[model samples]
Target: MENSAGCSVSLWQKIVSFLLVIFPILDIYSVGIKGIGIGSIILCFILIGMGIRFLTLNRSIKLNPYYGFFLYGLCISLLTVLIHNDFSITAVAIRMTYFLFYTLLIFLPSSYDFDIHFAEQIYLKIGMAAGAFLILQYFSFWGLRYNLIGLIPGLPLNYAIEDYVEWMDAYNNMYTIMFRPTSFFPEPAAFTQYMAPLLILVLFTNVGEKKKLLKAAFISIVMILSTSTNGIVFSLFIWILYFVYINHDSLKNRRFPIFLVPLFLFAIVFAILILFTDNTISDYTVQQFEGLFSKNQSSSAYLRIMRGFDIYRQLNFFENILGIGLGTYKSYYATGVLTVYDGETEYMNSLSYLFVSTGVIGVLLFIYSLFYNVPRRSMASHALAFLILLSFFSSSLFNSPTYALSYLFLLHLDSIKNSGD
Candidate 1:
C-alpha cells in the first residue's frame, strides 16, 4: 500500500510537471510584455514551487553546468544594468526570469519516473500546437489574404499592416513584411528562433516507433512553416552539416575506406538536394543569397546585418566589458528606430544582433553559458553546438532571447545523457 501510494504520487508529479512546461506560457505572455503576462506569472510560480519541492528532498544535487550558467547570466544582467543606465534594470529582470526558469527546466524533468518518456512527449505536443496555431495564422488566414493581394500584383503593401500603422502614426512609410503568426512571439522569425532548436531535439526522439516518427514529423513541419527562410534555411544547413559531421559513424553503415568514399559522396549529393529544394520554400532566404551574389535577391537582410554592425561600432569601448546597460537600445522611450545604417531593405540575422545588444564580452559569456554541458564530444554535443550556430545566423540581432528556450532544453538533454553515463 505504501509502494502504491508512492507510485501514484510519482505519476501525478510527472503529469503536473509536463503540463507546467508545455502550457503555452509564451502565448499567454505574448499578450503583454513580462510585466503584464499573467500566464508567464502562473507558470513561473508553478516552476518555482516544483524546484523548491526538489530542493527540500535533495540537499546535495551538486554543481552541474547550470551553476556556471547561472553565474554567467547573473553577471551579464548586472553589467547591463550598470553600464547602459537606460533599461538595464529591465535587462536584469529579463535575465533573472530566464535564469530562474532555465535553472528549473534543467532539473525539473528529472523529477519524474522514466517509464513514460513524458518530457519528449510534451515537447512534441508543444511543437504540434505551435505549428497548428501558426498555420491557422499564416496559410489558412494570412496565406489566403496574401494570395488575394498578390493576384492584383501591384498593391502598395510593402510593410505589415501593423508596421505601416506604426510608421504612419509617426508620419513615415517604411515597408515591412506582414509575416505569418507566431503563437507566443511577435513574428515568425522569433517563433523560428525557439522552434529551430526543437528540431535538434526532435532528432533525439524515439526513432524506433512509427507513431513517434509521425508525431515528430508533424511538429517539424509546423515549425518549418513557422520559420522564415532565414531561420528555416540556416537551421537546416547547420543541422545537415553538423549531423553529417557528428554522425559520420552512423553514416558509414560499414567499416572500410572504399565504402566510406561512396558514403561521403552520397551524403554530399543528398545534402545538395535538400538545400536546393528547401531553399526555394521561402523566397525570403533566396532573395538574401541572390542579393549578395546575384542581382535578384532582397537587400533588406543584408542591410539589417550592416545596421547591427553599426550599433556595435557606435558603442563606446567601455561598453564592451559592461553593456550600454540592458535595454539601452532606445532613448527617452520614444517610438525610435535604431537605423545607424541607411539601406533600401534591412533584415538583421541572429549573431550580429546579439553581438551589438550584449557586445563582445556579453556574446562570449552567452556562448560559454550555452554550451558548458559536454567536455567530451558526441553527436548530441555537435548538434547542440550547431543549433547555437544556426541561432546566430537566423534571428540573433532582433530576437536574441529565442535561443533561451533552446538552451535550456539542450542543457536538460545533456544532463539526461550524462546522468546515464
Candidate 2:
C-alpha cells in the first residue's frame, strides 16, 4: 500500500511537470482578461505554488549577482508612473509581477532527478504536432486560416479582430491566395519564432537519425511556406552554423573536399526549389530578398533602421537616457512629441522596444544577464543564445510567452551546472 501510494504521487508529479513543459504551446492561443496569454496566467499560479513549496522545503533563496541590476531596472520602470503624473499603480505592478515571477523561477530549488532532456523531447514532439497543422494549412487542406478571435471565459484566452484577414488579402494580391500557416499563433512571425529553436534541435542535434531527418524536412518546408523573411533567414543561418560547427574539426584537418560535398548538395537543392517549386512560395521568398534593399516595403529592414534613428532623434536627453516610460510609446508620440511612422505598427524590434520602454540602463542590464550571467558552455546553450539574438531583430522577446519560457528554461539549465550536479 505504501509503495502504491508512492507510485501514484510520482505519476501525478510527472503529469503536472509535463503540462508545465508544454504550457507555452498550449497557452499560445489562450489569452487572459488582461490580454495576457493563458499560459502566463497559469504560470503565475505555478510560481506561487513552487514558492510555497520552496519555503516548506526550507530552501533558501540565493540571489544571483545580476539580481540587483534587474531590480534597478524595474524601479526605473515604476518611476514612469510618477513621471507621467498618473497615480495608477497597475502598470508598474504588472511589470513588477513579471520580474518577480522571473526571479522566483531563477532562484527556486530544482529537483535533481528532473530530466531536462526529457522535457526538451516532449517540447519537440509538441512542436512537430503544431508543425503538422501548419503543413496542412500551407497546402490549403482546410486548417485554421483565420485569426483565432474571441475570449474563452474562465481561461486566459483572448483574441481580437485585427489585420490578419487584411494582411492575407494583401499577400494574395501580391503573390498567391495561399495562406501563411500560422498554426495556432496570432501571426506567421510568432509561429516561426516559437518553432525555430525546436526545429533547429531536431535537425541539428544528435537525436534519432530517421526521425530527425523527417522532422527537419517537414519544418524547413513549413517555414518556407510561411514565407516570413526573418523566419527563413534565421532558420537558414542556424542550419549553416550547425553544419559548420559540427564539421569544424574535419574541415580544419584538410578535409575541404569532403566538406564541400554537403554544402554543394544543399545549394543545388535550394536552387532547384527556387527555380521550380510553386511560384507562390518561391516568389514570396524572392520578394522578401528584394525587399531587403527596398525602403518602401512594409516589412523593410531598412525602414526599421531608419525608424529607429527617427524615434531616437525625437527623444529628449532625459527621455533618451531614462526612456519615456513603459506603455507610453503610443501616447507619447500621439501627444505631438514626434510623428511615429505607420502609427499602427507595434514594436518592430525587441531591442529597440527595450530602448523605447526602459532606456539604456535597462538594455545594458538585460544584455549583461543574457550573456555574462547565464552558463553557456554547451553547444545547445550557444545555439539557443544565437536564436534569441536573431529573434530580437524581429519580435518583442520579453512579451512573448514562448520566448520568455525559452530564456527562463536556459536559466534552469544553467542552474543545473551551477549546482555542480
Candidate 3:
C-alpha cells in the first residue's frame, strides 16, 4: 500500500514530489506574484515533511556528500541576502531548494525505479499538455480569440502582452494576442529548459515507450517553431550523443561511426538542402554562426555574453572571488555601477548572468551542487555527462530558475550505487 522501507510512507518524499511536479506549472515568477514570500512556503512544507518523517518513520539522516554542496549554496545565498538586503526573495527561495533538493527523498530506501519513472512521466505529461494547449491557441483561423481580440492563452485579458519583444513583433498586443505557443511556460527558453530533462527521461527508459517518445519529439519541435533555437539545438545535440552512447555495442563493432557518422552527414546535407529550400532559416543560421567570429558580429546572444564579460571585468577581485550575490544585477544596473556591452533583452545569453549575479564562488557552488550529487554508480554516465555539458554552455546558470531544475534532473540521474564505485 505504501513505499519507504517496509511500506511506511516518508513525508519528505511527498513534499518534494509536490515541488517538482507543480512548480513548473505554477511558475511563480510569471507576473512577479510576490507576497507570502516563497521562502515561507518552502520552509512550511520542509518542516512538515521532516516532522512527519521523524515522528512516524524514524528515518536516519545518512551522511550524504551532496548535503555539503547544498549547505554551501545555502550559505552563499544567505550571505548574499544579508549583504544585499533588497535582493530577490524569490531567487533566494529558488537557490535554497537546490541546496536541499528532491534527491534526498529519493535516497531513502523506499524510493524505487518506479518512483523515478513516475516522476519523469508526470514531467513529460505536463510538457505535452502545455504544448497542445498553446498550439491550439496559435490557430488564428479558428477565430478563437477571447473578447474578439483573444489572448493566445485563450484567456480574456485587458492587454495582449505586458511588453513587445522586437524579435517576435513590434506591437505588444499582437505578440500577446497572436499566439506563439510558449505553453505553460513564460517563454520558449523556459519551455525548452523544462523539456531538457524529459529528453533524458526518453533515452533512459529501461523499457520501451515509443509512444511517449513521439510526444516528446512533437513537443520539442513545436517549441523550436516558436523561435527558440538555442535550447532545441543543444538539446538535440545532447540527444544525439545519448543515442550514440546507448548503442555503443553497435558503434564499436560496425564500420560506421555506428550511426552517428551518417546522422551527422545527413544533418549537414539536410542543412544544405534547407539553405536552398528556405532562405530565412539558412540566412539566420549563417548569421548566428558567422556572428561568433566577428568582434561585434553574432546573434544577440553572443552580444549578451560579451556584455557579461564587460560586467565581469568591472567586478572587484573580491566580488570575482565570492560572486556579486544572487539577484544583484538589477541593483548594480540601476546604480549605474555595471553594464552589459551587448545589453540585456529577454533572450540574453546566460553566461554573463552567472558572473553578474553570483560571481565566481557562487558559480563554483552551483557546479558542485550538480556534479557532486551524481550517484555513486550511474549506468547513464554518458547521458549524465552530456546533460551537464549542454546545460552550462547553452544556458544561464540562473535564468528561468534553471539553476535548480537542471541540477535536480542531473543529480537524480547521476546517483550512484554500491557497485558503481
The best candidate by TM-score is: 2
RMSD score of candidate 2 (Å): 5.6
Query: Which candidate leads in lDDT?
Result: 2
Q: Residue 102 of model 1: what lDDT? A: 45
Candidate 2 lDDT tens digits, 180-286: 55675655766777777776556545333556555665666566556677666766776676667656544456644544543454465457446644566666667
Which whole-number lDDT from 0 to 100 does residue 250 have in model 1? 56
- Cα-based lDDT for every prediction: 0.48, 0.58, 0.50
Per-residue error (Å), model 2, residue 146: 12
Stretches of candidate 1 exceeding 4 Å from the true structure = 1-25, 28-36, 64-116, 129-186, 210-227, 238-247, 254-285, 288-300, 331-339, 342-350, 375-378, 396-402, 414-421
Q: What's the CA RMSD for each of the models?
A: 8.2, 5.6, 6.6
Tell me the lDDT of model 2 at 253: 63
Q: Model 1 Cα displacement at 50 (Å)?
A: 2.4
Encode model 3's per-residue lDDT on 267-364: one tens digit a residue: 65335435433455445544554555566544654563466667778888887776665444666666677665644622234555555556676566
Runs with alpha carbons beyond 4 Å of true place in candidate 2: 1-13, 31-34, 86-89, 102-109, 112-114, 140-176, 203-214, 250-278, 300-309, 414-421
| Per-candidate TM-score against the hidden true structure | 0.63, 0.78, 0.67
Model 1, span 147-262: residue lDDT tens: 11111122222223323234233321111343434554545555665566555555543434446434534544555554354544544554465445535545456354333432
